[model samples]
Target: MKKTVRLILPVLAALTLAQAAQATTPSRVVQGTTELEGEVAKLGETFTLGKQSPLNFTLLKVEYSVGHVVIGNTVYSPKAAEKLLLLHFAVHNPQRRDVRYYWPDLKFTAVDAQDRNHPYAQAVARDGTTERLEINLKPAQKVNVLTVIRVPAGGGVPKLLVQREAALLRYDLRGQVQPLPKAVADPTDTSGATPLTQVPAALKTFNPLERFDVRLDDVKFTGEALNGKAPAAGQRYLSAVFTLRNMEPGGGRYAWSDFKPMLRDADGERVEYNGLLLKASRDETAGGTLGAGEEVRVRFFFALPANVNGQTLTLADGTGRAYVYDVSGVR
Candidate 1:
């Protein structure tokens, strides 16, 4: 048995490495005018901005801002010799299932007039103007992405090398810095309830939440204690499934801890998620950097006294911006 296991291990390792190699092969976008066969796109390249790629994605538009840039309700001011850039894009997922779109995971570099390379700023701009680290999307979801990168103060961003997966897309950034008009409010705001139309345009900057943008689409509660397991003595388990969308375009980092969750009773008494319940539903509480244009369905579980009623769930982003959902229907 030992000999057989040793023999199979090497073969399994070889197969895994082969699969990884094949998965990293570069794909081309059908819309780019000039496709460089390699990963680096030098200056003078004319890559199409909005064409859908063979990878099932696209880069819609690119914008830049200097000095103090205001996105939503936050302002981003660069340091002494640095400038901020806003790369706007639309990443579409044509698949039938949810896919992970990581914007910051993509590499961005700036090339100055003197042929120098400056890496993307390590720290992303604060607020919704930035991107999430990882974005999980539902089927056929098209997310509008806004990404901000910092470059040197003086040298112009004549060329930008964008590396996505194994492919390299080079865009000529010369003369592309357009002035931003006044930020406008979405007409739908007056409707009262947040829109979950799944349309990209519906994703607007939600105020009060400083670093991240999120709106609760819908909530579902299971009256039963547990779906696949039994409940504890005198305690009943209730689960709330929430559809959350990360609104940052530059794709940075967010976590489950960021959206502090709490439960309040009819009398205004507050309680948190049961640690044991969270342990059982580990996948439901998983947290990390949510990519721009990504949406995640998170399930939060609480164990309450069987007779307790009239409860509400309050979820807050890192900025203390919160939304309350009434759980009274489950009673």
Candidate 2:
């Protein structure tokens, strides 16, 4: 048995190496026209991801131009194709000693109006050896690790946010990437739309219809950097964060195997959304049901341009309650 196992080990290593080679160089950095291929998309555009995005599946890839990519599957409306934003993160391992880093596990966290940390996140955890996950980085070799963020329907935020606290992605380029600093959110990004202070206001003031329940002891919102500020007159896209306490009350030992979010435009235009910011899916409501004093939070970012407006938010509860608030920008 020992001899047989030894013989198979070599074959296994060869197979693993082959798979890695096939995924090498997921994107190319060439000086040319501005165009995206396949299901990759930019803001204010339409695209698709073919059939690669299976329900609850994750995608991992490395790029040479961009450094670190994180786009959630929850941020799409029905009009969006499966593949939306294909982010590229340029990476390099320019050292003789191989190193590794772990991308922190994405969670569903809640933020208060003051950008204070709110409890309640998705039941997901990351596996690492110590400070970071083990990734074998060869000397002068680089690769992109692609992971998929899946959202079935009502298991996410209106908009999923991608950020780094202390350059979480370690670049072994030895200062080569100095000029090309880490990507920061500017007025161009969708995040800069509002500040954290507005989270409580967005929830309380927007709760004109009481779409949300008082059981929610936790509530919060997040602001995006708006480098590309929208016209104060034209239609603009928008989003926010939300935290719920003791949600789904009156249900016996419950779970959300089939919960989905509901979205609408300014003119009461309902959008067929899967989920966003955090992502909403049947599994999000899976495992167990909401307890009496449990609280949860999720970011909500969607298209609420200056012209087209939506003044209400509603949970798919039997009461048919709605939350209305005064939003910035124009309608």
Best by lDDT: 1
Please provide the root mean square deviation of candidate 2 (C-alpha atoms, Å): 26.6
Best by TM-score: 1
**Model 2, range 205-250, lDDT digits (tens) per residue?**
2221111232222222223333234324443445444554432234
Query: Against the true structure, what is each candidate's TM-score?
Result: 0.35, 0.24
Q: Cα deviation of 254 in candidate 1 (Å)? A: 25
The models' CA-based lDDT, in order, is 0.53, 0.32
Supply the global lDDT for candidate 2. Answer: 0.32
Model 2 lowest lDDT segment of ten: 74-83
The sequence of per-residue lDDT tens digits that candidate 1 reaches over residues 21-40 is 88998776676576445443
- Candidate 1 error regions (>4 Å): 1-36, 39-55, 67-76, 121-133, 179-331
lDDT of 1 at 239: 67
